[model samples]
Target: MLNRVILIGRLTRDPELRYTPTGVAVTQFTLAVDRPFTNQQNEREADFINIVTWRQLAETCANYLRKGRLTAVEGRIQVRNYENNEGRKVYVTEVVADNVRFLESANREPASGGGMREEAPQSRYGNQRSQQQDPFSDDGKPIDISDDDLPF
Candidate 1:
């Protein structure tokens, strides 16, 4: 009875936003997910998955997300069967997103030399800033932790 899916991947293209006749916002996009293992040729394989979002989330995704942006989506898989014009039956499967998390942080530093800078993280709902601070020191030093103090 469980039909849940969690995916973290890069977008294949910009999200397309539209509205239903009742004025509800809807967005559709494709995500490119890399396979866990590489092929014999040493190239990693990828799967392009179709995703759909509804309401406010859909609007937010369409407005802020772009091609190649990394994102995490939580949703359920949906499968449907249809008959084509050639009288052939086809099966379609896609993810219907319930909630989406923008994985890339918005506080990225500018790129050196003339390359594209890394994107900062953005919230889908509003511009509320994050309060969580990094555990590491500003000078790239790690926080001291002793094995004897481990909770696990």
Candidate 2:
């Protein structure tokens, strides 16, 4: 009776935003998540997952998210089938994201795009506090955490 999925990964490309006939916003993108274990060739593998977002969230993601940006997606897995033009049934599996969190700073150069970067939207999924340093930064600097910061 429950269907939920949570994934943390980098975006494979910029989100494509579109509007439906009813004027509702929709976005589609792919996320590349790494596997926990290496393959027999000792190489790490990844799974490319398709993500879809709707309405305001879709607009926000398309405007702020870019290729190679680390992000967190929370949603449900969906599988639907439809007949193709060739008279074959095509089954598609994708995640319908309800929430998305940006995991990187906006100051860094994007993986592909080159243009003026606007400030991200202010929301739970967007930047919350601008002045506070992110403890999970991937800058290779040692984090300074006190005992009180630990849960256990």
Candidate 3:
């Protein structure tokens, strides 16, 4: 069985970070994902998804990410049942983030006597080499390796 989800969207609001009773860091936020197709009026639709991050990733998201920041998240979908104040059963669904990637550099305030510089790239998996240029530049292009050339 496979249960996986990949989403690239903008945050609708700033991440809310808090610590559990045991001092475990946790963060929750909503992401606005635009639909691939347009509506009847040719307007793009968006879905607000709830995401939860834990531990170090949670702290990083809350510290760096903010409203309208584009982000890429990889995680699994979870559903749970709970009781509300009126004793009604409620079903909740959310994404439990395993990893998150900041997609854009935060705009920095201009420094005196200098132009604005791009912020340094940061990632949970260390500084990732920027692939913004062309993630699949080699696709359908000439390649030196062939199936028969494989050692396996």
Give all candidates' CA lDDT scores. 0.80, 0.83, 0.82
Q: What is the lDDT of candidate 1?
A: 0.80
Q: Write one digit per residue (lDDT tens) for candidate 3, span 46-134.
A: 99999999998898889888899878788999999999999999998999999887767667332233322223446463345575877
Worst 10-residue lDDT window for candidate 1 reads 109-118
TM-score, one value per model: 0.70, 0.73, 0.73
Give the poorly placed runs of model 1, Cα more than 4 Å off: 105-122, 128-152
Q: Count the backbone clashes (under 3 Å) in each candidate.
A: 5, 0, 0
Model 2 whole-model lDDT (C-alpha atoms): 0.83
- Per-residue lDDT, model 1, residue 129, is 49
- Candidate 3 Cα deviation (angstroms), residue 99: 0.7
lDDT of 1 by residue, 1-152 (tens): 99999888889999999999999999999999899999999999999999999998898889777888777888999999999999999999999999787765433322244222223444457444468785454666666779988999
Of 1 and 2, the candidate ranking higher by TM-score: 2
Best by lDDT: 2
In candidate 2, residue 42 scores what lDDT?
A: 100
Worst 10 residues of 3 by lDDT: 110-119
